[model samples]
Target: MITDTHTHLYSAEFDEDRAAMIQRAKDAGVSRFFIPAIDSTYTNRMLTLEKENPNDVFLMMGLHPTSVKENYLEELAHVKEWIDKKSFCAIGEIGIDLYWDSTFIKQQQEAFRTQIKWAKEKKIPIVIHCRDAFNEVFEVLESEKENTLRGIFHCFTGTLAQAKQAISYNMKLGIGGVATFKNGKIDKFLNEIDLTHIVLETDAPYLAPKPFRGKRNESAYITNVIDKLVDIYQVSYQEIAAITTQNSKDVFGI
Candidate 1:
């Protein structure tokens, strides 16, 4: 009954063996798959995947931070268009990214704030994608703090204080392959945080767990993440699975 609260199975990297990878994940007890949006370009592919695996795959809509550029207004409009027409699990993979380019920092912040409004209006959870911009993310989140602005901090790799700050906004921390890396420091900080605020993810076709590190990742690899959690928290696999799955359901209502 393992749940991969976040993944990107539709990426071109999985083109050849997508079905096989998903089947392997199911066989490994990775039953739930939450698909995130990269941008408008992948919308059709995302819908196609959801249509094929409606029972296991859930969809989210938003403009990813890196995708925020000069034409960000149009991207935000597209996100709103989808939310207004149909139901999505969340407003996700959205936030600030200064790692790649700082040229659009201001635009990224503006776009993130606009999407936050849509998430609040639709009463859906948010999935934040933070990289080299934790302070920027916290700034937006702090200003928009409210009951409806609840969600997960995808691929969290911040300090214990940052984790607590995110929790204060009624958000969950999305733990993934990074936690299993040999030099990964996420586990050190995560051990200090409450598991009640943790959710499992693969961020698939990327961030593969150790032993499988640097390899193409998929939901099936989440088993490795679960194994690490058992050791970190000194709890049974089933116990960690059950609690994390429940935590995911509490946030996504899936």
Candidate 2:
């Protein structure tokens, strides 16, 4: 059974056919999905999604970096309230995103660090949402390094060295649609990294894999990602699925 380590299955993009979309994924062997939080706004939908598909849907709590706006404090509070009351798979989609505005860089850093602390305290993993701010994110992670600081570096788009550095911190590289793009460089050096440190993701409603590139992504599209890895690692599709899904189990403990 294939597992999508990261996917926004609760996104409004699937509103018209959420059930169909999920069924399509399951029919395609994409049976497990881990959902990340954006903010308090998506909390109810995330909860309802899990409620409807408890066996297949697992959730994570955190304030996404891009959502670190003026009311970020309130957003963090919302995250904490649910965190204290629920047993999420991870604390994630957290980290710094400089690809957009840097106006709230400090706030993003603070939020990232705080959430990381909460994750450590709960003895859970964190899913990082780094974009154009690897150095900054690494610095914070460096300061907070500990035996229990483990997670996925979501949508990892970085160099071989960066991959090694992230792995050094006990993070598995979250491979996604970018690995299928001709210009997506991760595929070039992915074989060098052991399969044990990689996990598959769709990051759906965005970053759709090749052939579906530039279009809306869904969990069903994860097979395209698995196909690319079959070529990159020169392994059978079943091996890729088994290894990556096992890697995800290692990270999420689910």
Candidate 3:
């Protein structure tokens, strides 16, 4: 079975047919779904999704990098509260995002570092979201490096060297639809990296693969991603599925 290491089934893009979409994913052999938090705003909906499909879905709690703003301290407090109150699969979708606004650059760094330390304290894995700030994100990861600081670099689109660096810190690369895009640089360099360092994802409601590119993405489309990996490794679909599923389990312990 395939495990989509990251997806946003709670996204409004799938509001019309969330149930059908999830059913489609299962039909396509995506047996597990790892959901990342965008902020405290979606916490209730996320919890509801988990309640509906406890065995199929796993939840993570954190303040997304882009979501870090002037009131970041408040957001971090919310994250900490959730962590202390319940069990989450990981501390995630957290990192530096300079892609959108540089205004919150320093604030993002502070938030990212704090969350990384929190993850270590909780003895949980982190699901990172690095965008337009690879070096910045790397810097934080470097400072936090230790046996305890480990997680997945979600939607990884970095160079081979960066990929190596992430792996060196015991982090897995969350490969999604980007690997299937025609001009996607990730696939160009991914062949050089071992599949063991990879985990499958869709980043759903976004980053849909080719033929479905630029359109709304969902967990069911994760098959296209797996298809790309099968071509890259020249392995059977079942092999890719099994390996990635095992990788997901290793990271989330589910």
lDDT of 2 by residue, 1-254 (tens): 99999999999999999999999999999989999999999999999999999999999999999999999999999999999998999999999999979999999999999999999999999999999999999999999999888999999999999999999999999999999998999999999999999999999989999999999999999999999999999999999999999999999899
Number of the top lDDT candidate: 2
Minimal lDDT window, size 10, model 1: 182-191
**Local distance difference test, each candidate:** 0.92, 0.96, 0.91
Native RMSD of candidate 1 (Å): 0.8
Q: Over the stretch 158-250, how does candidate 3's per-residue lDDT look in tens digits? A: 999999999999999999998998888888878899988999999998999987998899899988998899899898999889988888888
Quote the positional error of residue 218 for candidate 2 in Å: 0.8
TM-scores vs. true structure, each candidate: 0.98, 0.99, 0.98
Worst 10 residues of 3 by lDDT: 142-151
Write model 1 residue lDDT over 12-125, tens digit each, in one string: 998998999999999999889999998999999999999989899999999999999888889888988899999999999899999999999999999899989989998889
Provide the global lDDT of candidate 2 against the true structure.
0.96
- Say which prediction, candidate 2 or candidate 3, comes out ahead on lDDT: 2
lDDT of predicted model 1: 0.92
TM-score for model 1? 0.98
